[model samples]
Target: MIEFKNVVKKYDNNITATNNISVKIKPGEFVYVVGPSGAGKSTFIKMMYREEAPTSGSIIVNEYALENIKSREIPFLRRELGIVFQDFKLLPRLTVFENIAYALQVIEKTPEEVEQRVSRVLDLVGLSAKRDNFPAELSGGEQQRVAIARAIANEPSILIADEPTGNLDPETAEGIMEILEQVNKQGTTVVMATHNSFIVNEYKHRVLEINGGKIIRDEEEGVYSNEDANA
Candidate 1:
């Protein structure tokens, strides 16, 4: 579960990335954060993951007040959250298996536990066959699958994906969505930020639209309304 109340984020020179935004995502729910470029979607996701601190207001994720979270405690907070990015953020040198295993290793998991968890998640993402491959050796979608595998290997309670399908073809993107949906069905809360209207329309889930650093609309089983088509 995630909750934000009157959250604001401002950069130097008084440019606001998020302006007094409040939203809640319940457990076992799937939501989409929809917006155009510079609409504060990224900032919103970053705040949830503690990548950037909000300038004001409060954020409660899994019952921990983010404003009161100490710098030394961020790693523990992140242990309960899974994050994926548009760029696929895979290391070129590490094999797929190693990449996913690295996530567990950082948490001080034993080698046997790391191997078991990484193997299971890779199988879940249909990347078991490609575990020995490097990022450059895999296709875009495959690399993204590996990235997803890495994110979920530790079984985080919440999953936040930013432009997860940004670089893939339509079919590939759809495949990625299916995997995300499957993950959601298994009880991980999913919040995906995307600009793809076709996918949003097809999925027909809760949609939150943001513009000019504020959330403009939140709808259940929503479509992409083009009110800010020119924004």
Candidate 2:
């Protein structure tokens, strides 16, 4: 579970990225953080993973107090999270299978255990056939799927996706969405920061609309924007 209480993040030059935002995300829930560019969406998501610590406030993610957690402990905290980025951040030299296996390699998993975990996640993302392909060899959707596979290979309790479909075509984006949906269905809490209105409206979930560093609206099963709902 994730909880934020009076979370305020301020940067240099008197800029506030998050302003007294307090929210709680329960286990097994899919939540969307929808907002305009520079609306503090990325900053908000980064805070959860401790990429950018809050200037002042409390952020508890899966029981780790991020505001004051030691640097060494950050790795432990991240182990409990799966992060998928818009740009597929895969090692170009590594094949799809190796890319996923790399994530599990850091842990105490044996070679057999690594292969099994990689195979399971690749199967989950429907990319088992492309296991030997390199990132450069696959299409955009395929690479994204590989990224998702890499992320979830360790079975993190929480999955955080930041603009996961930003670079894909409509059809490809939908395919990616299906994979994410499947992941969520299997009980991983998903928190996605996205600007894709079609995906948000099509796949209804709890929506947190943020702007000017504040959560303006929090609606269950909400649309991408208020105007879309009215229209």
Candidate 3:
């Protein structure tokens, strides 16, 4: 579960990425954070994952209060959170298996454990056949599947994604969306920030709309569009 209380983030340029945002996401719930570019969606996700600190207020992710958490304790907090990015962020030279395994390895998982977990996640994402392929060798959607597999390799309690399907064609993006839905069904909380109206309208879920650095709407089984996001 995640909760934010009057959170604020202001950069040196005096641009406030997020301001007075408060919301809660329970375990196993799927929510979409929809907004146009520069609407603070990225900063909201970053704060949840501790990539950026809030300028004020509190953020709690699965019971860890991020306001005063030491830098050394971030890894432990991240152990319970999985992050996916728009870029796929895969190492060009590493094979699918290695890419996922590296995540487990970072947490000191043994080789045997790593191998088993990686194998399971690859199959989960329907990428078992591409285990030996590198990022460059795969199609965009396939590469994103590998990235998803890598993120869930640790069995994190929550999955946080930023523009997860931003790069793929609509059909390919739909495929990625299916995988994310499947993952959410299996009980991992999913928080995604997206601008794709088709996907948002088609796949009903909780929607939180942000603009001018604050959340203005939260609705269940919500529908969203870029135009509506600017309101």
Q: Give me the candidate number with maximum TM-score.
A: 3
Full-model lDDT for every candidate = 0.91, 0.92, 0.92
| Candidate 1 regions with alpha-carbon error over 4 angstroms | 225-229
What tens-digit string does per-residue lDDT give for candidate 2 at 2-84?
Answer: 99999999999789999999999999999999888878899999999999999988999999999999999999999999999
Give model 3's TM-score versus the native structure. 0.97
How many clashes in each candidate?
Answer: 0, 0, 0
Distance from true location, Cα of 66 in model 2, Å: 0.7
Q: In candidate 1, what are the lDDT values of residues 114-184, reduced to their tens digit?
A: 98999899899998898898899999999999989989899989999999998999999999999999999
Cα shift from native, residue 120, model 2 (Å): 0.7
lDDT of 1 at 9: 95
- lDDT, model 1: 0.91
Q: How do the predictions measure up, each by TM-score?
A: 0.97, 0.97, 0.97
Determine which window of 10 residues in candidate 1 has minimal summed lDDT: 222-231
Q: Which lDDT tens digits does candidate 3 get at residues 53-142?
A: 999999999889999999999999999988999999999888999999999998899999999999999998899999998899999999
